[model samples]
Target: MQLKLAGLEDIEDVLTLHRKYQIDTILEEDKKDGFVTTNFTREQLTKLIQEEQGLFIARHEEAVMAYVMAASWQYWSVWPIFARMIADLPKLTFAGHTLSTENSYQYGPVCVDKAYRGSGLLEAIFEFAREKMSHRYPVLVTFINQINTRSYRAHTQKLGLVVLAEFEFNNNHYLELAYDTSKSLSLHQSTHGQH
Candidate 1:
């Protein structure tokens, strides 16, 4: 498997994977696994690749098995949920720093193929995106819907993201989580020798 930033050429494959788990189109039974709320279009994805440089993916045999999106608050502020998150940043603290746009970036809507759920691909791809974004920001922030226990556990238990606060947006409850970018799984792996 390969983990790297996604270029424009990879958008179609990413979208194909996204549609299978997106909230609107996902199968009813599949919701328990997890679902992505945002439905990104080709135009939006193009901007994400060219401007934000924030789309990361994990590919195996040329298939996009998983993807993670991370970008500045400004890039995300257009969405109401993100706008609210941006306004609440200063009130939350993590990793010995007061959160703000200058010091942190929003991450999420990560999707992994069901076949690879328990194989540690999530941690690998997540850390790949986090390590790259750390060059510009010291912190990474993301919000997961309160009902999505699958995602909450994966992030908190597997990836070690801390829940800074919980808030309601448009009547939907969400858990806001953050991670210190300075900490890398590669470093952790090097010391513990875990693949």
Candidate 2:
């Protein structure tokens, strides 16, 4: 299978994958707690992709596998008004977020097709982004539910990431992981001639 940045052509697959996760599984503990309803629209994802604050996806001769989005990166802002608006939305899992966040680019809503669960693609997703994120964003932060052992393992064991802290909101625990690029990290090595 092949991997590449998703374009307009993959909109349908991307939307399908997003909806499948948001609607089918109890992705967010907030939903189970009765605080918000998880929801996403194709228009929103399409617009986000156009803005280039995240990475969209497509697979080799297959449906869109998944997507990975930077928490607050390029072309992004922390306007209080925008923050307030997002806080009040349905399925607002990231309830306690603020404009005065911290250093690093946080990652959100990483997902892969259910059919490809054991293929180590998730690790590759981090590798793909980690390849350049060291300099692009400097620090990459992601909040994975502490109970989600699979994600935690991949972030810590497979990718050699470090757990910085844990955050709690709406009774859900999220492990904040960071990619420290200060040392001789191979993640910073150039891959221009690889095939």
Q: Top model by lDDT, which number?
A: 1
Supply the TM-score for candidate 2: 0.66
Sliding window of 10 residues with minimal summed lDDT for model 2: 91-100
Cα lDDT of model 1 by residue, 113-187, tens digit: 999999999998998898899999999999999999999998887787889999998899999998889989767
Q: List the residue pairs that clash in candidate 2.
A: 37-91, 71-106
lDDT (tens digit, per residue) of candidate 2 on 1-195:
666666667778766776666635545642332111234466655655676536645375767775665545433334332343233323222223221234355565577766676677766665665554545545555557776676676556656666755666567776666665342334433222211
> Clash totals for all models, in order?
0, 2
- lDDT score, candidate 1, position 3: 90
Assess each prediction's global lDDT (C-alpha) against the native. Answer: 0.91, 0.54
Error of 1 at 79 (Å): 0.6
Reference-based TM-score of each model:
0.94, 0.66
